[model samples]
Target: MTAASFTAGLRSALRQRFRTLALLPRLLHSFWQTSPALSAAIIVLRLLRAAQPPLVLFIGKLIVDEIILQTASPAPGPTLADWVESGRLSAVAGWLLLEFLLVATANALARIGAFVERVLTERHDNALGVALIQQVASLDLRDIEASSAQDRLQRARTQRFMGNQLLTSLLSQAQDFVSLILFVIGLLSYAPLLIVLLLLALLPTLAGEAHFNAKGYGLNVSVTPERRQMDYIQIVGSVAESAKEMKLFGLGAYLAGRFAELADKVHRGNRDLAARRTLWGSLFGAIASLAYYAAYAVIAWRALKGELGIGDLTFLAGSLLRLNGLFERLILGLTQITSQTQYLDDFFSFMDLRSTMVAPSNPRPFPVPMRQGIVFDKVGFRYPGKGAWALRDLSFSIPVGETLALVGENGAGKTTIVKLLTRLYEPDEGRILVDGIDIRDIDIAELQHQVGAIFQDFVRYHMTAAENIGIGRVGCLSDRPRVIEAAQKSLAHPLIETLPEGYEQMLGRVFARGLDLSGGEWQKIAIARAYFRDAAILILDEPTAALDARAEAEIFERFRNLSEAKTALLISHRFATVRMADRILVLENGAILESGSHEELIALHGRYAELFALQAAGFQ
Candidate 1:
């Protein structure tokens, strides 16, 4: 808002304008690729439409001249019958009909063009949405979670929503530019000075438009974080995911108040900018009107002095008025095109983002039947932008065909280790190996395909009961028998069987006739999904965190039977479950404190033993 900042913004806007102008061809290419037939039709329509305006003006001039000639000459009688008898009315009458035909045809063509434009714009918008979704799927978790990326994504989404209007503006901009050129040629013959004066008048208006557009864009980008937060607050207040929590906490008034506060701030900023823009715009527009009339007055004086005819005066005035409008539109269109291009930068930048979480071009073959177990050689990992390590100097092994239970308190690196094993996040130092081959060398998809994990915070998709379980093994999503078997193994089948629609019953309260399960029931469904995977390495990151003690025991007992032949990784705070594992690892601060059989650890009476005894004492 400061004078210096405003000046800097103006300079930046100018640069953005030229840069965007260079990218205009890319947009044209996108349109062409959406539908070649529609693209060609639009171009043809614009060409015809652009030439029609100047042609109509010229025809008007001819009609006016014919009228003047007929009135001055003593060729026609007062009555139409007498004029027809003398054959003096035919020439002027034919001229009027010719002009009428041109105008009628132009109107018909405009209607056809509008229909074609509507279809083309819809197709382009759908195509863009598909492309954005595909690109987002390829992005890394880190990139997708970043606040800056979300801002860029928000702006990009806004631009995408303008597909229909953008297409119209582009075609209109092209048409107006062509019409302006033709109008100039017509004006030059009458008085070249009028054309020059017209351009000079529009300069101030152009500058004002460009300045306000930049300010508007600046404000939008600055408030993106707030906008994203506002959206989140609204979702939390109204969405099924948070409905229970919101009501439980009595947060309706608090959330509404917060939303009002943020929305008002954004609205007031926009209102202030609009007021200034309108004031300057009005002044510039008045100046433009004055320039047009100055040229009209000059032409009228020439006509009165017999230097020009009445038809020439009329033609010149009409042409000046049209040229004035076209120039204004062209300037405004240029500003809009330039402004939208800033958002296009965000979209293209996101599309160009390359994730570090990709397989090598020449990937080593993944370990089939992974023989020698998984190993961590002095591994360390820290999340992006975090100063502290999530896991550091961690060296361990989980032998093939063994169930290793990792016991730890919150933030003890147990889940981080699970993430590393799954290759969701790679280590900052050292390496993890599968049967002596570095896991990084394996294909990313292949690595993921072999390891199935259900974290504590698993998603409960608002889909059919069958789909909820089958999503873990997408290849078997439609295989109903497989889904039922997995559900039975996870002890979720009994509850699911009671649903009105059975396996087809919709989950969550989002839809009509949908069923919302309790926390523990949802956990059963999540565990069933993991079971459906039938992965070689099954990881349960406290998937039973929501279950009661008896339910937890029964679920793990079923898991032990189902996974007897497969390697497993279990993370739980429950010492009772920990004692069932082939081996126990106690972790703290992302490093392993002790590791042994449960009996050996209890015999040693270390941290693990003390924690185990504390829990056992509670039971007694």
Candidate 2:
């Protein structure tokens, strides 16, 4: 890039940094409310440190003058003894002592500042983290399933860590820069030419540091895919879903080897970049060191020429050393802020993404009791990137307090139907209605409250058994009696009683004292959760998949009694289990092929008859 372009980019980056800093006050204000005394103390300590450097340099010059006077022969000028008698020497000595005390005080204050800043930053991070997570959890299920959503989530987490570090570094650098400016002024009063030399000395070091930072950020962005792959492998190798299969198939070693290969590639790339950076950094250091010592030599030579004195030499030399240290720290801080800005961009981008499914400007309250049943009026839907529709322009309805069964082959849109009813995804065409009102008009939260659903792939939380069941009902998940009653209704209570801790036992092997339940047992727990909800509409999708013949038979026999007054929709492949439904709908390739009672459909000799006969033939 040309110099002009680079300068413009740097200016833009600085502007962005200012914007982020502008946000810091509101953040700090929040912190102050939480802990006012500590925040005030931290601000005071920073101010004190900012005032210490110039005072120390001024006192050092006076002490050098006093020493020179003490060693000189008595001349026409005021003698050392005369000056002491006049109290000038006493005043200089007192100032030197005070400077020493401030130095010690600054050090103590710095340590306290470090501790307090760390504690407060952590507090802020935790609060923000919780808020962000809550927002993510509230997003529509369809939004979360998008491919780009995971990248946004990863950026948010990384930004939280980098944002804290950037804030602390920026604050510390501001204080140091203020102190450096004052010290430079004191040095200029003694040797004006040294000011120009100090600026020249900082240029090469800053350039070199900026180059290294750019390389690091470029490397991080380039390796994102590799890093993500490595992370995925690690999760699969260690997490519950893959643990049993990994061991049984002896695939652990293979996954570990893949992980190591990616790690090695990352290490190799980093090593090469580091080597190049070290070479350039050393070259810059040599050039800077030459300029620094040359300035020192000129100052020393000028002092010996009788045009300068001992105090002048001491002040000039001390100021040069202090300026170099301050300049280095400032440059490093700038580099850190620049790199962290990219992470901040990623974070804000995630927060800025608009959810595709937005609530209406003024949502209507849902019907209190769902007097009429749900109706899908010519509904259709297609996956985000797929060409074919998962559901076509199909219309269906179920009456209140009735059981409807959906039977279909794999990829026949049966599960997609349930998802739409649960508001997991919005239809591309037409609308679904509850109580003859469009579902979109109702408040989403209220709509969800009235529906309970169990999917083929239900989440098995790594929590206590009671919690697992209680999650079906909003706010009643923790009510012990309600949890037990739900579990009993679903025929899951007997299975829980067999465990060591009964309903309180942890349900996943990842935690200490956790027990992994059988698939059938887990399915029962999921059913219990749905039962616990006590929602007006209940959906069971392949709820009997893990059960044996006897268990499935028993579950179907108790289904009507357990459901009671609620409208139920069951999606299953087993003809025998679905035969008990008041009405059955046969779906094929995103369209309803037939709808009737099982005997009526069988008599039609259509898709339902074909599927039912196939299963019966298997038994024969």
Candidate 3:
């Protein structure tokens, strides 16, 4: 590396370390939130344990000193019993007993602290998981769909599982810090020079740890997208959703190879970093150890010269050894914390994101039984990262109590209209008015509550039959009457009743005891959600695409009768289905090419008539 590049790298690492340390306060607040009592208990237990180590070492010094004095004195008795009664060994005996009790107490405190930490770690993990779920739920659809947002979300989710390890490291570091302070205070009375030597010896190790930790974190960040791809491949290989295709196309080996390639790349990066860190760490550790023994020699030499007693020598030697180990531990612990803080950065950054599509402070109330109906007044929109417009100058209206059908090819912006109407994406230009009021002015929740829609690609949730339909109106999930009525409207009641558990039967093959249904049956269940919602305005986008001709006819017939007094919008490619609409609009390139009823459009011989004739001829 060039000198300039090395300087830049050092600056970047220092910045990362400081930034990570800043997150410590936030982590402490999270722990307190998880359980104030547990957090307080952990701190108290660790503090008490920290004081025991230095006190134990001091008791050892006293025991040794008392033993030497007793040995040097004249023999008080000839036997063990006599010696115990004479009081010659009394002082040494008391010191030994005190040391035993201190050691026992330290062991008990250590175990108790571990137990408390385990409980706190579990609670902290669960709390973080819930916070992540809530944060993701509040995001806008566009945010969720963006690639950059997905990477942030993945990093946040991955870091959540590291909460327990991070908590344990933090508590351990706290305990060690207190112990180091007590040890330092004791050594100051004898030789303060040894403390300075210890710091200098460990400086190299500290710098190396900080440097390698930053490199490790960078490696993990770069591999995040590949890691996500590997996980996706694993799911596809094992899940029931792709089981049929996997077997038919013999994709097992191909998927395995793809996963292996990505996994190997990640492994190589980690392996290279680990090798370098281990080499430098060993070299630094050897230097620290040599410095410690050199200090030990000085203490021994002072004792030999009669300047210090054997007790003082023993005490100083033990303190030097412990100080060496403790300081090393403290250094490594600090670096580990700084590293984990990077993960905490991911978690907090994700939580910090706010939805751009927010409701106004004083929003207009949604129209109850919409008066003038919905209108698109010269609305124009282009999807993000796309050069072409999805819709431009799209002007249209659905009058109250009218069933309007829209006919268009696949990319004619039909779905984009639905997304804009529901405020999933805001229009780049112009306004969408609901009951003559701009949709942006209406309360988002209330606006969504008043509209019911079912798209062609509906989710096959792995849940009970009733739950799948009941989720349409979550407030009425327990209303069995409403659920049954909605199912009946979609003609799904008979299919559901035939299941072993009826409405309680689990749907989809993902879970045990789940009974998977045919495409037509699932479509019927999806259609029932719109009925369950019973909103003022309903939209059915290819709602019967999975059904056969007879089933399609039956569904539309029921739809025509049920929606007679409701304001509804329909999108379908089938001319037979669109013929039931009171008004039909043929759309091409997001522009209205023809507008009329079935008979009027057929008579006008426009784009709609041409498509209708072509579809009708296929039936003949």
The TM-score leader among the candidates is 3
Task: By lDDT, rank the candidates, best first.
Answer: 3, 1, 2
- For model 3, the superposed segments whose C-alpha errors exceed 4 Å read 1-4, 617-620
The per-model lDDT (C-alpha) reads: 0.87, 0.81, 0.88
Clashing pairs in 3: none
Give a tens-digit lDDT track for model 2, residues 1-620. 46786566556555555555454554456567657777777777787888887777878888878767755745434666876676656766786788879889989988999998888778777876876787687777777777567766766766767657766776788888888888877877666676677667767667656666666766876777788789899999988878779999999899999999999999999999899778867887777677678888888888888767888778778878787778778876776676666666666566666667768788987776767888999999998889999999989998888899999889999988888887878999989998898888887778888888888899999999998998887587668999998888788999999999999999998799999988999999999998888888999999899999898888877888777577899999888889989999999899998999999999999989988999999999
Could you tell me which 10 consecutive residues in candidate 3 have the lowest summed lDDT?
Answer: 1-10
- TM-score (C-alpha, index-matched) for candidate 2: 0.88
lDDT of 3: 0.88
> Mind giving the per-residue lDDT tens digits that candidate 1 earns over 1-620?
57787678788889877876665677778889999999999999998999888988988888888788878878566788998888777877787788788788889889999999989888898998999898887677667777777887887777776556666888899999989899888888789987889889998888888889988888888888878889989988988778778899999999999999999989999999999999989998999989988978888889889998888887888898899899889988988978777666666666678777867878987777878888889999888889998888999998888999998888999988888888777789999998898988988788888887899889989999999999998888999999999999999999999999999999998888899999999999999999999888999988888899999999999888888878899998888787889999999998999999999998998999899888889989
RMSD, one per candidate, in order: 2.4, 4.1, 2.1
Clashing pairs in model 1, backbone N/Cα/C closer than 3 A = none
Write one digit per residue (lDDT tens) for candidate 3, span 41-124: 999998998888888888888988888888898888899988988978788888888889988998999899899888888888
Better candidate by lDDT, 1 or 2: 1
